[model samples]
Target chain A: MAGDRFPVEATHIMMFARSVADDNQIYYDEDYAKTTEVGHIIAPPTFVQSSAQFNPNYFLRPKVGQPWFGSGKEPTGVKRDAGGGGGGGGGGLHAEQHYEYHRHPKPGDVLTVTVRPGKTWEKEGKRSGKLVFSETITEYRDQNGELVVTARGVGVRTERPVDQK
Target chain B: MALKASQLKVGDTYTECLVEDLKRTQLVMYAGTSGDYNPLHTDEIFTTKVAGYPSVFAHGMLTMGMTGRMLTNYVGDGRLTKYGVRFTSQVWPGDTLHSTATVESVEDGIVNLKVETRNQNDAVVLSGYAAARVDS
Candidate 1:
């Protein structure tokens, strides 16, 4: 669990603002941001996923299954098998993510993010054997401790066979 | 003055683009700021040896942000009423992302549009619909 003591910076906010294609002057223009309800440039809803507060080692590479990569360099470091003291395993894939926003994100506002494992279950698939679906609940709050957004999504986990695309 | 929903025809199109480094440094920064630490994005060995992805990739929400920016820029403020998206594919580092929207339908004061996010290859990475209220 992280604290509000560490707030998100302005530069990162701006970077994410621009990254979400065609960000408007309201997010980049100081004059516009000052007059808006948020009183500062607000971040796009999509920027919620960029937070670095959570440790990637836990969610990105769970040791139970292998993650499917399209075609890029492989990720390195970290103990891939640290979950429950099991032998190292494979990676997983993000199946879906959904976000609901209460208010637009603004500049100069301190944000505190908290992430928790939402749920875990299994289901049978056509092509794949039994698949595991994991969901995580991510909540974002403003400097005043108001709930700004809530995101819940599933990540599909399965073992990567040697010759499967 | 609000644009009239009746004026927007189906099949209308809008586009935009941006450039940035989608490297681990930025990923780490986002993870730290956003509280998303999925190893498929930040860890290499875990991604390769375990996950089997070629390299770490960008978060789906990061791509969706690009989609939202397109709408805000196309129609200006107070114009976008409702927006939603479904992630269909994964985007990797250094991949140039492009977003576009096509008008789908309009009823009464409501206007519908099809929003899409594609990579350099023009593959539809994310596809969904958007609804906005036209000021009469």
Candidate 2:
């Protein structure tokens, strides 16, 4: 995901924390957060993934007046190839994710996102068919251009729907 | 409170029940917040009939986010310097998750940990590692 300004807001952080079932005051309560070592409210470890909300062309999100891939009057709004995977119909599934934090993001930090392709490889799987994996590296830098978080994500596309055990 | 390297040992571990019974609405919440509106995570008909799964499942990132709570609670908020994970298996509704962080080492005010999240059946859903700043 690439964007010029991904504003990290307090309410978004609160909702994101709630969705993950995290009740930590450091995410919501400023009073409690002030007493912590960070001395202020800080974003959760995986919170940067929410930057997808700022990605205008992110395919997973349905656009207005556009045919979405999800269900409507039928099982799906659009026709897809047969034998596609359960997650995204050859769009692939997330296989792995890694993050290195130069520092935890705070509420007011406006981050600039830059993405680059990493690597690709293939592996035969017992449960699924030919597994093709690709990686992407994303860097989140603060307004001052200091690297805040570096993220590496791997996605795998299967030959068909994975066989359930 | 942050962890102190002087008080920690290589084999020390901390665990938390991340979720008791996963719900589909929680998946919706995560999708809405994370902007990952992939139908597989929130659409039952599309998932079961079109994509071919028994039912809708949670996003791997959701599991990681929940597991992060466990980590921050152990190492203290804003203490983590590195965290990574591999999606081992699918997490479905009604599954309970338990996450653990085991201290692998502590050196020079830094602590490295082995992280793992298991379902109620003891199946590993997410496996990972993390590093954090600790008091000397």
Candidate 3:
């Protein structure tokens, strides 16, 4: 998933930090942040994942006037064939995520994101059945076209729900 | 404060309580902010009935984000150059998480760390590594 303009904002950062239960002043208080070595408010390390908010086609988000997979009356809004895995309701699980930061993003910086398919593989699992994994590499560049963050994400589709241990 | 290479050792470790009794509301907050509205994370009816899960679980990114808090707290703001993780297990509501970052090496004004997060059950939920600039 990618977006053309992922505008970094202070409020969004604050909310994101709160969701993770991080009370770091650097994420919210600008006055306190100025005393730090970075001397500015900085987004959390995983904040870039919020760019999904800007991705127009992000499947996880329910589009306006479109059918969502979440429950409404009969448990789900969308119908699926029995045992037909991999389409909606998250379809798969997040297997891994990696990030390389060229520099921490600050508010007012507009980022452009691009994504490319990486690799696909398969493995047998004990809890789940066969696992199919796919990778995507995303690049976030600043308005000046400088590469800011390189993110690699892997998603896995299992033949069945992972058997809880 | 930033970590100093001179004061650091290969085996030094830093730990933090990432979360205590993680609430489902926190998961909803994360899903709202991160734009990952996947039902498996917030819809119990859909997750349990449609998805066949025992209940809705926390998103992997949420655990990673909490773990990132621990890393940045240890290494300092804007210090991390690289961070990565593999989601080893599912995190459920009411699960308390603790994270640790162990100094793996100090070289050329940089520190490499091995990171791990575990639930109250002592199960590893996330495993990863991080690298950051350290003051010499």
- Misplaced by over 4 Å in model 3 are A1-3, A81-90
Q: For residues A1-165, write the lDDT of model 1, one tens digit per residue.
A: 874333555666666565444446665677876775446666665665655433344443333455432223533333444432111344355666766666655556667878789889988755445668899887889889997767776777655421224
> Residue B55 CA error for candidate 2 (Å)?
0.4
Better of 1 and 2 by lDDT: 2
lDDT tens per residue, model 1, B16-103 = 7743545566566555545555666676665566655577677666666667777766655545555666666777787877788888
Docking class of 1: acceptable
Ranking of predictions according to DockQ: 2, 3, 1
**Clash pairs (backbone) in predicted model 2:** none
TM-score of chain B, per candidate? 0.83, 0.99, 0.99
Compute each candidate's TM-score over C-alphas. Answer: 0.67, 0.96, 0.96
Count of backbone clashes, every candidate in sequence: 44, 0, 0
Q: Model 1's lDDT to the true fold?
A: 0.62
In model 2, which regions exceed 4 Å deviation?
A82-91
| Candidate 2: residue B125 lDDT (0-100) | 97
* lDDT (tens digit, per residue) of candidate 3 on A12-119: 999999988899999999999999999999999999999999988888888799887788887878778432233333359999999999999999999999999999
Name the TM-score of candidate 3: 0.96
Quote the true-contact fraction of every model. 0.37, 0.83, 0.85
Model 3 lDDT vs. the true structure? 0.92
The per-residue C-alpha lDDT of model 3 at residue A164 equals: 86
Q: Total clashes, candidate 3?
A: 0
